[model samples]
Structures are given as C-alpha cells and as structure tokens.
Target chain A: MPPLVLHHLSVNYQDLRALRNINLTIHPGQLVGIFGPNGAGKSTLIKAMLGLIPRVTGRVTWGEADLSAHLERIAYLPQRSQIDWHFPATAWDVVMMGRVKPTGWLRPFAASSRRLAQAALERVGMAELAHRPIGALSGGQQQRVFLARALAQEAEIFCFDEPLVGVDQATTGIIFKVFRDLAAAGKMVLVINHDLGESITNFDQLILLNQELIAAGPRQWVLSPEHMRRAYGGEVGFWGHVA
Target chain B: MLPEMGPIHWLLDPLQYDFMLRSLAVAVMVGIICAVVGSYLMVQRLALLGDAISHSVLPGLALAFWLGGNIFLGAFIAGVLSTVLIAWIHRQSSIKEDAAMGIVFSAFFALGITLITVIQKENKIDLNHFLFGNILGVTVADVRDTAIIAALVLGVVVLIYKELLFYSFDPMGARASGLPVGLLNSGLMVLIALTVVASMKVVGVILVLSLLITPGATAYLLVPRLHQVMILGCGIGVFASLSGLYLSYYFNLPSGAAIVLVVSALFSLAFLFSPSQGVISRYRRRP
Candidate 1:
C-alpha cells in the first residue's frame, strides 16, 4: 500500500516522442484510469513504470524504493492483441502462470498456490471452462482468464492495459466488480482504457493524455470539457460517464 | 532382407557391430536434445532462428577446421555469435528481426561454405558429411560427446523449466515480474547451439533444421502444454531416429535423409489425425 511517484518521465521510440515530461504521485486505494485516443502512449507509460521498457529519462519510486526492486508485488495484464490466442495452454495453465514467481525455480506449485488459482478462476466466473484451451475461448473469455491470472498473483498493485475492449457485457460487469473490490481492499489498481462509455464511471481518478499530460486528478476535475477537447481533439462525446 | 528377418533380429543384429552401436547411442541422444531444445524454439515462434543458428554454425565450423581446434566448439561459438549480431542489427537499425536474421545467417552460411571448400582441397573430409550428415561414420568419442551435451541440455531445462515457461509464454509479463529476460534468451541460444553441434554427426547442418523444428511442431498438434510437447516430441524424434537407422541398414539408404523422411511422415500423420487439432477434424467443423 505504498504511494508511487513518477518524476519527469519521458520515452523515445527512435525519432518519435511517445511520452514526454510526465510527473505524478499515485496513492493507494485509487482505481486509476489512463484515457486517451490511440497513440497516446497509454500502454507505454505503464510499461515504463514497471521497467518493461527503458525510460529515456526520469524515475519511478514506490514508497522511496525503486519499482524494479518491488516488481514481485506488481501484476500486469497486457492487452489482448499482444497475446497469441492460439498458444497451446489451457485456462488453468494461464492462471497457474500467476503462481510462477511465487512458486520459483526447481520446485512445483504448492497446494496453496493451486487453491489460490482455483479460487481466482471461480472469482472470474471461468472455473467451468478452466480446462479449455485458450484458443478455443471467445474474446471475452480470454480477457477473463487473464484477469483471473492477475488475481491469482495476489499482487498489491494491479495494472491492466485495455482489459475491456471487445469483451461482452457480462465480462465488463465482472471485471468492474473485481477492480472495485481490489481497490476497496487498499490495493492500487491502474487501467488503460480507450472506451469512454458507461464503464468510465468506475474510476476513482483519471489521467488524460495525448502524448503529454493533459490533466490528472479526481475524475470530476480531470474530465472537464476543456480537458476532453485537448486530449481527444474536438468533442468526443461525454454521454455515459460525464457529470 | 529386413522382411525375412524377424523384428527382434532386425533390432538385435545391429548390436554386434561396434560402429552401429555407437551410431545408435548418438542417434538417441541427439533425438532427445533436439526435441527438448526445439520445443522452446517452436513455442516462441522463433523457428526461423533455429534455421538461422544452424546455418550460422558453419562459419564457426570452418574457422575451427582452419585453426586445428574443435569444430564443435567453433560451431557453438558461431551459433551464439550470429544471434547476438542479429539482435544488435535489429535493435540498432529499423530493420525487422526476421530480415536481420535472413541477412546474418546467409552471410555466415556463405562464409562457411567458401571456407569448407578451401579447406577440402587440402583435407580429405567430404563436404557431403557436413551438409547432409553421415551417421554411419560416428565414433565412440562422438557417442560420449553427444551424451555429455544431452545431459547438460536436459539438466538446464529441468533447472529452469518454470522461468523458461513463463518467459516464453509471456515475455512482457516475465520482464515485469523481474526475471532477467536477456540472460534467459542468451541461455536458450546457447542450448540451441549445443543441440545443433551435438546433432551434426546424426544430421548435418542443412538438415538439422528439420530435426530442431519438425518434432516439436508435430507434438504441438497433439499436446496442449510446453512440457508435454517436449516429451512427446522426444518420443517422436527417437522413434524417427531408430526407424531411419533401421531403414538405412536394410535398404542401403542415406541415414540422415531416411530419418528426415520418417519424421516428415510422422508429422503428416499428426497433421491429419491428431485428436484435438487435426486437419481432418478441424476442417470438418462448420459455421
């Protein structure tokens, strides 16, 4: 439950400036949403924080400690398209991957780890399809399986990149329910979402970006019409979650 | 001749010859190592890297021959070097990895071919043995070397199975979880190189690509886990090796080509009849 701080972060992909001069402090118990149009560097920011990508400048610290030093307590769910659905792994196998770090090398998964994985599957409503190969599952089912993987990790800080895209309504509901529960339990939950529909209301805080920080704060203060125009270019509608 | 011989005699008669016995032991060991290392290559979608590394080992083999050093060690060094060059080229330039692999491997392969030709004029070694393999020419030392490599490869795989599994399945996730992906990747490259060097006598450089990729791919159709794929692929590889050896003995065929054909035939069977992912069943599904 430590606060995370980002100081003057920037990323360069060759000549392109993906993220520029970003700074923020994220506290626990917040369900944070990173919203922007395509190419806004939403996914890159998260990757950079976790050191999945090397940042050109700046630093990220989790409660006065380097984020890399505390990676075991973090769980990341990559976007769906980034994964090969045709990979020859069952849903149970994917969830068990969450237990991999804790289970470590030269050893097998403990009984407790297996029980945790089973519980995660049940929590995500995918227990019945646990034995099914990942390729056989629909888009929504795949996302749910990944969510279950994150839950099985028992991580303190959970980050998801586009978890709701192309999923069914049932899946959306279940995911939001779980995110809320995770936040309520004093865990820091960060999500990268491109959707601005009804689901945007679930966030406790919002960080809008379009290659640079637009505005970041409580949802109400961050989603003003002015900020919306700067991030999405012109009016992009605000029917579902805008108050 | 084999038709008249009982299956027991067909199997037992080979044991009388010391050279055949050495070939048999080396063939089995190569089968296991190739399948084990090849499983990782298949799952990572780096099958071409297998081709790249196999071809890249040539320059090393040539250089070792020139320097009066162990060709096997040279091949391993060149194999690892090619991967590093490929990675460096990919990162430093805008070129895609596949393109980088294509450029590096062909250049190294060409260098190897030229060097071998130059050396062959002065030496008595047949270039065919390096290109297509001569399993019948294996010695007791070859058997011992293959055994050691097999043990090392299987031991590392056992020790790091979980990390490799996690890394191959989701590299981004593995990196985020603090696993040293660069080291793991290099370790895998080293293993793949060792497998290629160990397999040179059983199936030469040009054909080792098939041994490295085909068995795992065949098993992938039938199994649903990485380890299962490796275990079943090893079985398929060993079966192909033994059957090919037997076929060569009875029919006066080239052992390497015969083994490759047996493996290809087995791959066709799995492609058409595997329970979960067979073409026959999958094609039968309708909207």
Candidate 2:
C-alpha cells in the first residue's frame, strides 16, 4: 500500500487556481523531491497533503488511517525564514516542542523527552549550542536547529519545505546527509526544493510540478529536458523576481 | 491615629484596612492572570492586543451601566466581542494588523464616550477613575470576580499550551500539522479578553496595557527561555503590585498607575541592562 495517496485534489485561492487535478501516491522509504518554479503551486500541493488548505476538494490518506488522525506521526519542517528568528527561546526549548503530542499537556516534558531532544540536537551537530538562543544562530545553524526539532518528532514520514534555502554549502550537505540517512532507514522524505541540477543527481524520485503534476516517477524518467522547460522556462522571470 | 512609619509599618498598615486587603487580592490575581496570558500574546507579536481590548471595552461598560447590569460582565462581553470582530476583519482584509487595531479601538472608544455623555449628563460615573483605578475602592465581590477569571485564563493556557506555542512560532507549520489554526487564534483572543476584563478593576481599562506588556517585555529583555520569561514576568508583576500599592498609600496616588509606573521602570532597566537581548547587552554582544 502507498504511504500517502492524494486523489482528485484541487486547491483554489478565491478565483485563482493554486493546484489543479493533482493525483499521486508516495511509497515509503522514497526520497521524493518536488521541483517547480515560483507559483508552480508546489507549496500548495504539500499544504494539501498535510490538510492545511481546507478549500481543496480531495482525499488524502496515510496508509489505512485518516491523515488527520495520524498527523503526529508526520514531521514537517517549514521554510527557513518563515518564523520570527528574534523570538526569545533556547535551542533545546525549541527542540523540546517536537516531543509534544496532540493530547498531552498536564505534565511538562519528561526525562525521556529531554533525552530525545538532546539526541536530536546531537544528531544535527548542535549539541554544543543547545543552550544558545535561537536568534543568536546563523542561517544554516537555524536550519539545523529546525532539523533537530523535526528529528525529535521521530515521525515515519518527514516533509521539509525549502530547507536548503540560504544555507551554506556545508550545512546543505549535512542536511542532505540526514535526509539520505532517513530514507535509508525505510522512512519517507519529501522535500520541496528549487536546486534542480543538484536535485537531479541527489533525489531518488522527482515529482515535477507546475500547478499540476507534469510527471512523477524515478529521477531520470521525470527530470527530462521537456519537464524542466515546462516547469521553469515560462516562469523564469517570475521566479527570478521572487527569489 | 496616623499610620506608623518604617518598612514593615508601611507595608502591613495597608493590609489593615478591609478595602486595602480586597484591593491586594484583586491586584495579585489580576497580575498573575495577565502575566500568564501576556506571555502568549508577546510570543504571537500581538503586543498591542491589550490596548485594543481595553479601549474597546468602554462602550460595553457604558451600556452595562445604562442597563443597570453588572459593569464587569458588560466590559467582559464587550471586550471579547470587539476583539473577535477585529480579528475577523483582519483575516478578511488586506489591511495591516496595526491599522485594523487603530480603527477598531478609536471607533469603539468614541462610541463609548458619546454614550456616556448623552446617557448620564447629570451624575456621570468618573471616567478618570476607570482610566486609572482606585485600588482602595475594591470590594470583596471584585476579588471574587478576579479570582474566577484568573483561574479560567490559567486553565486554558495550561491546557492548550503546546498548540498555542506551535501556532505562535510557526503558523504555516501549525496549519500543516493539521492543527486548527483559526480556532487556536480565536482561543488566544478569548484568553486575552478574559485577562483584560479581570485586570480592569485593579489596573483600570486605561493603563491595563502596562500589566500586559511591561512585565512580559521586561522579562523578554532579560531571559532567553519562554518558561523563564513567564516566571520572571509573574514575579515582576506581583512585586510591582505590592510595592506600588504601598507607595500609593503613602503618597496619596492611584495604586494601579503607581504599579504600572513601577513595572515600566523595570522595563526601562531591562531595556538598558539586560544581558543578552537588552539594549546594553546587544551592544555588548556586538563585535
């Protein structure tokens, strides 16, 4: 059975169509890279998968269970600059947030939760800076901190949005290594990335999107010149301006 | 007989009066509730939320007085209703949050003043008192009301702590996590309303913003953790409440304003000397 399935999905913002006729299934342990230019509705597609957009008409199922009920089992890392970096919070504190479940609130983070958070930080090579404030970190370090937070979730399926944006080469390599490790462990890793040339060589599967699914299959089969032209050619200026 | 002098004499003498005891209880409850709720508001960057609610509550107070109903209940209802409206309009429009808050606060405040002038032209309630509380005027009922509201606000904050923090830090992520982002947002507004209503008697509707913003802001400047910020803010709030009340009794001033002023002073000091986020600290940290 597919790890995640989306059927007859359509996302609209007022009169504009963000996503149209999206149907796809992702299997477990697959490293799927969603590549598209600006306004390609890549983010919207992911948002729909996570049930973030209520205006969409579709069914998204995870295994046999309702996707809504199994949200805690999915770890999501948003765009790097989406949050207020100046927020007064420690790195460990931010990581501890991942250990929270939908139902537990009475007792604070337990010893096991703290150990998990610490291990996640250690995995991201952020153990030394666990006590540092989130605002004090550099761009790449912040991304790593979030990765650590997601790591603490220990979810079966991991979804990351623009995790490599503005990150340094070293940190980017570390993040991809983490992704590779997750995929190797039979966990699903989905990333919305713009770095096409590298993504072609790195990702095992490519989901080409331009407001709809242009192609979805093995990397070489889906990353053909035709797909790139369709996804990026017409929107070169638009993407450049936004980027 | 004149009140005794000396530190213990000054502090304990105020508690000797029944009204002072009531005022102290109300202020303590209000301080605790505001600090707890204000931490969330500060994190959400809805720093001006208190300002909006306090100003908007005037119309409700006027209407309640006109109807001969409970003034606190009217203010509570009015504060919650107007805040919901502001949040809804904000979500539905392209107008920025600051502009939206400004528009709602002015309209409601003007409507309140107009109603008060027209309805009670002969024996009007003192608007100044509402703006600045007379702590010595608090009664047993006010203390009871403050406790109940404080308890409710604290309960909700503790129950929905993670959900609220998740949304405040990462709204898109929270939405993606299948959390009810809209409901959580409204829940925060309701908490803010309850806090404002509870704090109104002690801090008054006018300077209530101080209790909501000052201690939290001061703590933010000094602390690096959310939990620490909350604990420090509550401590500062209680300290300001007690000290301001004692000072007011001695100086013949409004206790609420005095408390706010003291908290503001601490905020200034934190702004100047706090280790990491403070003005001096930031400069010190700079290479």
Candidate 3:
C-alpha cells in the first residue's frame, strides 16, 4: 500500500490559526498516535487531512493522487461527543452505513455486506446487542459499536478520534488489539489520543502537536524531554513506560 | 327527519362532490410526502427550518400570482432561497442557526403578507385562504401537481435512502467516506422545499410545520429506526388527514386547522401512551 503524506497543511478558525504548516508522511503497517494538550488541534489535524473540514493550505496525498479523490479507502470515526447518540438507529443500522458507499449509489446492500457487518459486530463482541438502539448502549459499548462500523468498512486507512475516551477497560483492550491487527495487516492506522498513560506505549509512532508539528517520529524520540516541554509548554510527567 | 345514514354512507357522502374528491386526494398525497420528508427534519433537530421554509414560501406564492407564473414553482424557489439566506447569514457571521432562521423567515413572511394584502385589492384573492388553507377550493390541476411532486420526492428518497441515512446520522463521517456532503445537504433542502410547497394548499403556510414535524415526532416516540419512524409517520399523517377532513365536513371546521389538531392529538397520544418511550410507560416502569 502507498504511504499517506500531508504537505504544508494549515487550518484557521476565523482569525485564530488552529493548525500551522504541518508536513508528515505515514507509512503503512504503522499504528500512529497524535498527542497534544487541550485545544491542540489534534482532532482538527485528522479532519483537515481527510478534508472533513476546510483546510487553509495543504494537500493530502495517498500515493500520487489527491487524498480527497480517494476517500473510499478511508474509515474515519469521529469523536463520540460529536455524534448524536439519540438518533433513531440501531447498532446494526449504523454498521450498515459503512457499506453504503461501497454498495454503490442507488443500490441496496448485498448479502455479503450484511455478513461483513455481522462479522464486524461479532469481532467487537457486540453481536448479541446488534439490534439494540445505539443511544441505549453504554459509552464503552457505543464506542465498540462504532469500532465495529469502522471495521466493516474494509478500508486501507483507519482514523479514529478519541476512541478510548470514557471507554471501559475491555473496550480499550479491544481497540488497541484491533489497531495492532490492522497494522499487522499492512493497513495505515492513525488515532487521536488524549490520555498520556501507559496506553501511549501501544502506538508505533507519535505526532506531538501544539498548533504546529512539534515532533513526528518513533514514540521514544517524540516523547523526549525537549519535545514534550516545547509541545506542552512545560516539563510534563507521563507514564514511564512511554519513554 | 331524514333516514339516518350508516358509517360507510357518512364516509362516502363527501366523495360525491368533485371539490371534496380533489381536496382529499391532495391532502392524502401531501400527508404522505410531508411525513417522509419531515422525518429528516425531525432527526436533524431542524424542525425550525421546516417552519422557516413553510413560512418563506408565502412571498413566492404572492410573487408568482402577481407575475401569472406557476405558483408552485415560485413557492419552491422562495422556500429554497430562504434556506440559502439562512445558511449564508449563519455562516458569514457568528449568529447561531436558530436565530438566523427566525430572522430570515419572519422577514420573508412579512414581505409575503404585505405583498398579498396589496395584491388582494385588484384580484379576487383571500389572504386568509393562504394563511389557513382553502382545501375545498382545490382543483383537479392541484391534485395532479401534488401527485407529481409526491412521486418525485418519494422516488429520490428511495433512490438515496442509505446515503441520506448515513449523512443524517454522521455528516462528518459520510464526508470522510467520500460522500459529497454539501450536495447531499443541498438535495435535502430542495426536497424539503418541494414538500413544503406541495403541502401549502392543503395545510397553508401557517400550519404546514405541524404536518412536517408532528407526525414524524409521534412516530419517533414509538420506533427505534429512522425508516420505521418514516413509515409510521406516513401512516399517522394520512390517517390524520383523512379523519380531519371528515371532521371538517361534519362539524364545519377549518380544514387546515382540523388536520393540524388531529395530528397534534395523535402526537399527544403517542407522547403519553407509547409503549417504549411514552411518559406513562416510563412512569409505570419506574417502580
């Protein structure tokens, strides 16, 4: 698979610059985590890269072509808070949404798509509750359902924004395991993470940010004291396992 | 005293008149399309936008009447224009969407009322008919126009059901998945405008919001899926329209107000007695 590259990406919210010139290349088979403090544009970075939001200046490329033109190969899970849990849809319905574009416009989902959705639900241990309304699920279960949806997409690139927030330990374990499995299968995985705990160790690479690209490299290099100080604006303490 | 008529006779009595037949046809078609399109508005928390568009169509109606153009086409154009103006205002400034909708819709409604009052002097037009609906005045041409709009709206909805479902549930995710979200949003607006314009002669601009939102909301209280909500809402809307027309015929009530009242009554029943999400059910389950 071709690597994903971002060239001089920038985003602005009115007069405020949310993200500065960001340039990075993400290779396949890597589980990448984006780390930043509150308001650090971590979510903005993923959104801009995928063209979910307007980019002031940037180009995202998957191989030689513009990434926007090939969005079918991407599976993106937005922050849970951004979703309307009260929407009148069951878990099965949401998971089926992943198959909509692939099923082609004006065509209904095939039996194969149903099988994929069922398998994805089973993989997330949510098969028993597939018919439950999404709003009725617990936070962890809801996150897992969304993960199942992403899994059903069968995409080459996966981008999840804060998938671990407010989730239970079982969900966290399942998510990291899935991330690892995707990387092992040579799929590109990018996650926006808020916790600076031992969970940071699960990532193969780290992109530290504070309105700009502070550092982008292996976990150890990105977590260096100088980079952490520069990114967090102070000397910060994190899980020793990260170092 | 004349011989008492049976229930079937009472029901079939109104069908003998050409006007009642046309009115009923228009009402039933309007009811089905409104409920289907209104499900989107209900789910997206854009009920106010429905009200906005309904009210905004008035100016277009008056302008079309003045220009001797197709009134439905004018109403559709005006409804769409109001939505665009609302979006533009909210996006260009810090004003929130609800506030923007209120400002634009009211301004357009005022302009419409003013234009209609001025035009009523020369033509045999009644502003009250537009405001409260004159379903009895529906012609065969009106019935035909409504049928075409209903078919067009339902066809597009069926054709793009999954895309619309995904986009409504998660716009950012849909866009990230390579769906043209902007176009989908605009398409939804167009569908809503068409629904609103078609519904005008049956419910009028003032009460159209009730048809657009109440039935969907009533179904939402009983169903867990969007499609089920739409289906149930359609049933509820058609029943209300039919029964409301009957009530109007028997009791000499205004057609549009009677329909709105019937729909609201159905919503109240669902709110109070629905099995899963009703107030009474929740209260009963609490102990």
Best by DockQ: 3
lDDT of 1 at A71: 89
* Candidate 3 per-residue C-alpha lDDT over A47-117 given as tens digits, one digit per residue, 9 for 90 to 100: 99998889999999988899988899899999988899999999999999999989999898999999999
Clashing residue pairs in candidate 3, if any?
none
Using TM-score, rank the candidates from best to worst: 3, 1, 2
- Candidate 1 residues A84-151, lDDT tens each? 88776899989998998888778988999999999999999999999998989989999999999899
Per-residue alpha-carbon lDDT of candidate 3 for residues B1-287, written as tens digits (9 for 90 to 100) = 32389988989988998888898998899899999999999999999999999999999999999999989999999999999999999999999999999999999999999999999899988887778777676888889999999999999999999999999999999999999999999999999999988888878889999999999999999999999999999999999988888887787777889999999999999999999989998999996
Fnat, model by model in order, equals 0.70, 0.65, 0.91
- Regions more than 4 Å wrong, model 3: A238-242, B1-4
Model 2, stretches more than 4 Å misplaced?
A64-66, A102-107, A234-243, B1-5, B122-124, B281-287
Ranking by DockQ: 3, 1, 2
- The candidate, 1 or 2, that scores higher on TM-score is 1
Residue B156, model 2: Cα distance from true site in angstroms: 3.0
Ranking by lDDT: 3, 1, 2
Model 2 lDDT per residue over A125-224, tens place: 8999999999998899999999998888888888999898888888888898899999988898999998755544778888989888899989877766
- Residues B67-141 of candidate 2 have per-residue lDDT tens digits of 899878888788888887787788899877788898998889898888778776766677766777887668787
Report the Cα lDDT for candidate 3: 0.92
Poorest lDDT segment (10 consecutive residues) of candidate 3 chain B: B1-10
Candidate 2 docks with a DockQ of 0.57
